[model samples]
Target: MPLILDALCLARDDAPVRRLIDALGTEPVETTERRIGEPAVLSQHLLFGSGGEIVLHDDAVVAVILHLAPTPSAPRGLDAAEWLPGVDNDATFADFKATFDVPWRFADGDRYFVLEAAYLRPEFVKHGGRRAGDLQRVAFTVDDPRETCRPADEDCPVCRELIVRTGDGSFDLDGTVDALVAGVEAGVLKESSGAVSLADLRLLHASALMERVESQVTCTACGRVACLTLYRDAPPTFGYHPLDAAMRRPLEAIPPVEEWGDAARIAEVRDAMRYVDHEPGLWFLVEQHGDLYLDSRYTISSMADDSCLIRLDEAERQEYHEAGRDSLTELARRIDRSGPHREASPFHRRNLLRHPDEGRDYSAEVRAAIAGHTWLARQKQAAAQRAQAGSAADG
Candidate 1:
């Protein structure tokens, strides 16, 4: 008999984890669009760390699902359970909460939480630390803040005692601890088929999960950080650099996960990702020491062409202006001088004409040569036209 398997994104780049993909039976990615002509979504997910948050639910665990077959597609963004039990009666995450009554999912840390029951035996903290007990089963979910909500000076999620706003900007527990439990109970959160064993988890966790950009930039207007973007021509010798928006400082408020590995690196990467919009096909400008850089990183794209185009925000424009000295006028000058005006030949006199009255410098010899060439070329064309006309008349 075949064993049941769980699915997840292995690399989410060009290569999917062979074992993980194989567990899915190597099915070519199947895309479904909610509407026609809209991009279809791929759902191959790459899961890391124990899935859940500490304060119960706000969505902290970083897991990514992507498209695999038929050449990489965007995610559909729809899940089976809108709320526990398929999204119908679920309490409002904006202000509602779902219950994790007993026999419920990991209650301690989950929301809209999925599984009703699961036990990872002999559970140890991400780091080798105080055993949080035999990892006996647990339940968690995004409980409704209604009961917890009371008329206080500030009734907002941030100010409310039990309610906290989620990354998606809804009031809920700290993380989506509740959501995971809800998915499991609702039969949406299936276990990974090629489930990584506990030992494997620790080993992989120790390794660096991703690459880091030493440099980054910030949007002065929005106070949003910009992640790295890729371009054929960028600064710092034409390579990618970290954008300030991608930079993150220690988040004092969000609950911390006690997973294994150098917490420092995880923290660093997490900070970078937080500022990154992570929308498909997005790129940001990197600013460093009077130079602007584009990072050719493949983040969240189904098919990340090594040569990808990026959307720029104001911060990036300023960085390029400061570093590359690239304003409209400067760019025009460079294009004319470096790209199309390298030779002084009359044929290549350049498109932008300098006005003699303006006293813009120009070579007298080059100018005279160009004038002569223009006269000669025009006469040749005119003579050809006259000869053609004469031949027609004779015929």
Candidate 2:
């Protein structure tokens, strides 16, 4: 089985291709040239380092560079697709990432190209007399991991207490009920005689009440923000938290920073922030690690960092989420304002808009996210009152 790495060809010229080839430290051992399709599909297969090859496929117009290692014995190969097949129990992503110390990073002059690594293994099924296998991705975009990282086994006192109280493997319904009743008392919820459901109090839990049965909290010691989600199967444990709508716009504007350890790092880089909302930020889990990292973007003070609460927006949040990706940067790279962009076919346009298409309307999303904030709510109220006054004057 071989490994494959496929990156969307970003550059207008062949500079990125040449840089990648140079970085991999291999030259073409065998070159196979072919063309297909109505407009002639021009492609070149350049074999390198025993079984490794770089395939440059063009629509005779735009091209994509594919890196492949077609044999299992080939060094530093991933079983990505049908071309490269590996056993299901072969080397895992962590195993490869731990040892493969090649310079995967490529830079042409000032421009740096970051390649997201994907590791795959082949899954096999036995036919009547023959065995067949297909490549299945086991891991995608695995980071260059830091080996020393380990999870702390002990939970904080609050979490430990919650686990103890709910050790019978049942959700704390009584506590949830009490929290709802309190919301009514605090004028945050409508008065109801009948029993209140958890479903009805989702917004209340996301907004007014912080310390509730199913609530979110950030650990002071480790700076991990976790949501106390309702679980029936096991003792109450915090799962991956979600970002509330109100906090999403603020999060989107904050610039990406390297992993910060303490509050001081946030303070240092705080002033350069574009969006600085007082409400709690989103909880972010560290990639491939058990520890939770709060998205305390542009938090000026350590006090604000600790005080800020995160409301998990369950509607939009999904698993396998990629954080800190600048979609506009990707959009700009794909769309060519110069050169033969106007002459490019509709097929090429679709390819360019694939990832960043829906993401382009992100400003609208940001505006919608902040639409429910207190300031916006007040503004809407004022506008409504002014409209009423104008109608009265006309009458």
Candidate 3:
């Protein structure tokens, strides 16, 4: 049988077909691709920073020159922050970010394209065999990784901690110093092995550092500001350090930062950050490496430069968290716009909008993602607000 007779031939122009045919040569799938889940890599563009770590999933970073869809409301420029209640990097970004999904940034010259995830969920699940009862897990776009440099269905907490450590373990940063000495000796400490020289410790100290300090977050709604000292262990340990939230009054503080060794105390506080479920932010943990380096698009530990984690004053952390909430809340608004999009084919299940007969497309998938993002963001934001409101009311 000749090519294009399988009944799933999506409409196409003759010129494009000739080009595609030339590119694929004589391969069967190449000459006659039809399925939505074809093996292909979905790529987009991003603004590569001049500093910090950014390791894309396949090093296949292409420029995303997005031409506005040509409508009044069509976004004129790239402003990812405008989207509220953003998706956690893992769910939408993790195996789901593909050519099908939207790009956050674009390159200057080239029009972008999409390719495969290297590992497709359909192929993965199919290989595992017919156990339908199991909750199916499918990856869309994977988090841009720094170390691995490719998408894999696993977690690396080491990477997470590494990013954190390199960035600023916490607010408790003592100005970062290469010390020109090893963490073991040329500086002042010895290795666990005791045999390792001080020079070797210097290698480990090469990462970035930040110190823990007092901070507060102001309410965007009520304009009420909450003052609190940062703590080493729990949110309670940090926020209620003076134990004031409990008493609803400031008083003689209990244990103070000086009582505890800065290094040990800082470690505990840093560890606690991994658990805080604050309103999500644009940058997040895509890969974790033993609570150390957190791999993400803009995170990195691989470099020659050095910078100190500026000790944030009371107002900084508050501002940081507030900005984060706004970022997430805005992402929530993007979902509302998705409902207007078209869907794949009439044959596709769970499709809500009218079919265009043109064939399967990204409408349904993007819409579903946006809707889910909106719901989750609102739930989290509401819960946070209620907690803060309850606290304020009690005081």
Candidate 4:
């Protein structure tokens, strides 16, 4: 039985191929291009030599398999514990990292060995294998926050409490670990250890910290913003005032209030309008004088008293004509440019129109608009009640 050590790593390029060849101290006896895997085939290079086998693909050293020769005088397989320390060292780990430059910043880039029988499976045989259960596997990853954090303008208390900086400007891993342990002990960060995915670990820490802070605070160390405060001693104490109708209107419902060539075009147009109302796929702007400019998606019409008086502009008329809407074009043409017209219909009472292709849900926008209207109505009723009470008292 032969003992095998399989190391999976990311490589920056094929440069690690040459490095591995040097480290192994053996020339390849056989080299072949092989497509491995089923359903999704992967193109890989298989190199067989006296040392072991190397699998390479897309500038990544998918696996580096080492075969330990058995000695007649010793046990059938090499000692797994003895070989584990050799790969964990800086010199060995750096070479391992070079072979698999997987564009990740690994935290505590140490090799951990686990003995398993699954290494003998036929699927993993391309990376080199034998019938022996004395197989060790190691994985490297760049998913640590300490590896990703950058210096910030203002230090975040949470980050400062978690990360520790060394004299060389690199993170002090041991110190950082100590800080993390302290955070957990103090109930400021969640406890995570052994086998937990790096992403999950980071999330646990984030969720724990967010429960303590109220306002948005940016971490000076990593430049991450924490805004959600999940836990509070008591509910916020403040009067809740509703926003104005204009402020509450959805951005999609608001038209661009600008004249084509004027500097203060938007301001001028906005100043002249009383308010805008929207329903589903249609919206209208009501002028200060009560005249309505409506956009039905298909036509831009100027209306009063439930009647379509005229098209607002030549562009609008052309649009309707181009769309083959003959009735709307004819209606725009027949409108009498006479002296007086009736007042525009109340927005709430009018029958709303919809566009053929507009499938989006405008219920939220409609609800927001209704809330604004209700708030305004309540304000007016309150003022009237106040005035009537004052009049009765005076009489």
Q: For each candidate, what is the lDDT?
A: 0.26, 0.31, 0.24, 0.33
Q: TM-score-based ranking, best first? A: 2, 4, 1, 3
Instruction: List candidate 3 stretches off by more than 4 Å.
Output: 1-117, 121-130, 140-158, 164-395
Candidate 1, 1-395: lDDT as tens digits? 01111112123222333443343335433422111000111212222122211111111211222111112222322221321242221123322123333221111122222222221111122332133221211112122211111111111222112112356644342132243234335543321211221222323323323121111222222222212211123311111111211211211121223343356646553433122112122232323232332322222235432222122336656755576534423333333334332355221333223222245332332233233234334545654564455345334
Worst 10 residues of 4 by lDDT: 237-246
Candidate 3 is scored at a TM of 0.15
Instruction: Point out where model 2 deviates above 4 Å.
Output: 1-7, 10-13, 59-89, 92-395
Per-residue CA lDDT of model 4 for 239-276, tens digit only, reads: 11111211221222112323121345445445453435
The segments of candidate 1 whose C-alpha lies over 4 angstroms from its true place after superposition are: 1-62, 65-79, 82-91, 94-215, 219-224, 227-395
For every candidate, C-alpha RMSD to the true structure in Å: 28.3, 27.8, 27.6, 25.4
lDDT top scorer:
4
Clash counts per candidate, in order, are 70, 6, 71, 11
Residue 134, candidate 2: alpha-carbon lDDT: 27
Candidate 3 lDDT over residue span 210-317, tens digit each = 122232222222222223232233231111111112122332222322343356654543433231122343312211123211111111134421111112234434
Q: Candidate 3 — worst ten consecutive residues by lDDT sum? A: 29-38
Task: Give the total clashing residue pairs for model 4.
Answer: 11
TM-score of every model versus the real structure: 0.17, 0.20, 0.15, 0.19
Q: Candidate 4: misplaced stretches above 4 Å?
A: 1-13, 37-41, 48-50, 69-83, 86-395
